[model samples]
Target: MTETLTTALIEMREDDVLAAVRAATEAGTSPAGIIAGLQAGMKTIGDKYEAGEYFLSELIMSAEIFKRALAELGLDQSAAGTGTRGTVILGTVHTDIHDIGKNIVASVLSANGFKVVDLGVDVPAQRFLDAARENDARVIGLSCLLTTAFPAMRETIATFAAAGLRDQVSIIIGGGPVNADLALQLGADGAGISAQEAVILAAKAVEGGVA
Candidate 1:
């Protein structure tokens, strides 16, 4: 059943994936097991995207399937924070309206037991700080697909530093234009090329370690 779910997701069969998730749930499959299967599928999808076997449209479709499966399993925002390992505030930095990558990261993190406070796209630096402070998040993830948003990422990090909260939380940046060096330059603790890596980085961040 799990394999079916994974296959359905990897194939971007939205209806099939939804059916598989529903069937698994009715069969009393654990939510964690279902989520793990979905993550496996997403990992394959990510790899295909990187290898150029899948394009942006396909990637977006896969993400949508993943989200639908999660919703079918009753594990969307309402289920966030339940048995969570920690809280993470995530958003696209100012002037960036792109959110596909950020949404994927949020779903993966939430599935992995991290409560995600998604501040949405085109978010300002101050809003990130406010959400982090309100949730006492252990990590902040900034997403930006445009090179022009690098400065915004820097400003977001600067705001954290200016507020004297830099040390209290870890900052990680992602999206097409972000890299480890860029993250460092912007005062972030780390950067991830994919949502899977972001989950690992966020885990390390919560443990007071950098990835």
Candidate 2:
């Protein structure tokens, strides 16, 4: 886990957990060990945010650092054949450039050994479907920060259903404007308040079996 983190951190140097992942992986740490470290770090960051010790800008910076570290580790390939890891398609809905939460979720999922295919911000419903098809992802995560873009989230899920892929993957959603009730209404499998919580929800979705 430590090794996984080291590699992940190296790839996602800008984000908090990803860089830590690289540091831990380089030391030959196990995947589980790396995840534990990331969970701790994410919790710390969340606590800081709750206490007003940090702001959205700081959170965004941290997420960037984590993202770079994950890229450095080539986590997409490393996650394969790892029993606890699985592939996920993640994106922020169209017309919304805010990706702080999406980026954080991607980093945490990557650190936890999940292969995350992040479709960056302002992603269209078609692109989300394309990514899911390309990756054969079992999980689909949507992030929407703007209230106006909220409908895009549902459209993405509906697109999956239209393509006959909805039942094949578990859809999870979050971000500034997302709520559990809304997500459920949109047909998502679950919702999370933070990226760490998203990772946990994704894991549960995976464990319960996608589909």
Candidate 3:
């Protein structure tokens, strides 16, 4: 972790984190290195959220802060498409309008060399499948903030299988109310508890396609 940036991010100091990111970028720090630091910070923040030390508001605010840091570095999703390692289709599951986590995943993935097709929030299963098909994406990320959206995730996976693309593309799930067991139960490739882990999962999923 970029110690300064991670500390500022853990404390939710937006200005300080941005300053650190800028300083690091100017010092020729690789975007991947900088993102690793931010990712560590995000993991800690997520831990706090899971421990009940942080509320939904803090979790949302932290994601917003991270998004801004990415934008400051020009490595946000806008810069994620050039010379991509692989394509990933990402979105909030149907009936789930929350997008904080999904946005963070997109930013992180983009900064880490992935091309992300973000489908935004409340996206249907067919939309996810269609985007994956259209982009030839090898990895799909599903984010859900509400229990109500769980069914949609299940349906999304089922839709992929029904389309005969289940074995073709890897699917990963994340966000509140989702866990590793739930991911297995849904028959997904994996579950990401944090943005950094999501990157790892996506990369591995793409590697699976390559192999």
Candidate 4:
């Protein structure tokens, strides 16, 4: 890992990290190495969140900064399946436009080398199914910030089952209004309480395992 880049990223200095990524890419840094640095940065942010030193706004800002820098690193989206890591389809459930948490999870997964297909906000159940099917994603990440969107989460799972894709994709739910109990009630495979937990659980879910 690039220690300097990782350290600067932990400090949440977007410009510094971007410079490091650019320099590394130009200097022949391997894609895996650059991704490791990004993942380290995400882990730092996750630590801050767990320590109550970072808020949702901070998390979202950091995610966007990393995504922009990663894009500059020449990551091949078309080669998403080239890595040993499995694919993930992430989205903010239908009617839920709050995507801060969802974006954090997606960024973390991306840094960890998981091919993430982010469906963005207000993603309907059918869209999730379509993305999962199209990408052959191993896991489906659902984020909800409102209790009203809770039904959308359940509907998504139902749609997957109806399409005979439920067993093929593990469902993970997260965000402010979500909890382990609700996740279980909704028939989800797992629930993530924080960005760190999301990364851990997502990796496991993709492997057809859980934490």
**Number of the predicted model whose TM-score against the real structure is largest:** 4
Ranking by lDDT: 1, 3, 4, 2
Tens digits of per-residue lDDT for model 3, 86-116: 8889999899999988887786676456788
Q: At residue 179, give the lDDT of candidate 1.
A: 85
Model 1, 1-211: lDDT tens digits are 9999999888888899999999999999999888888877867876776677876566667767766777787767436233266888999999999998999888767655678889999999999999998998879999999999999999999999999998888899999978888877878899988876787799898876554
Model 1 stretches with alpha carbons more than 4 Å out: 30-33, 39-59, 77-85, 95-104, 107-113, 145-148, 194-196
Per-residue alpha-carbon lDDT of model 4 for 15-93, expressed as tens digits? Answer: 8888888788788988778777876777788778778888766677776766776677665533522235778889999
Order the candidate numbers by TM-score, best to worst: 4, 1, 2, 3
TM-scores of the candidates in the order shown: 0.73, 0.66, 0.66, 0.77
lDDT (C-alpha) at residue 36 in model 1: 80
User: Which runs in model 3 stand beyond 4 Å of their true positions?
Assistant: 1-83
- Model-by-model lDDT, in order? 0.83, 0.70, 0.82, 0.80
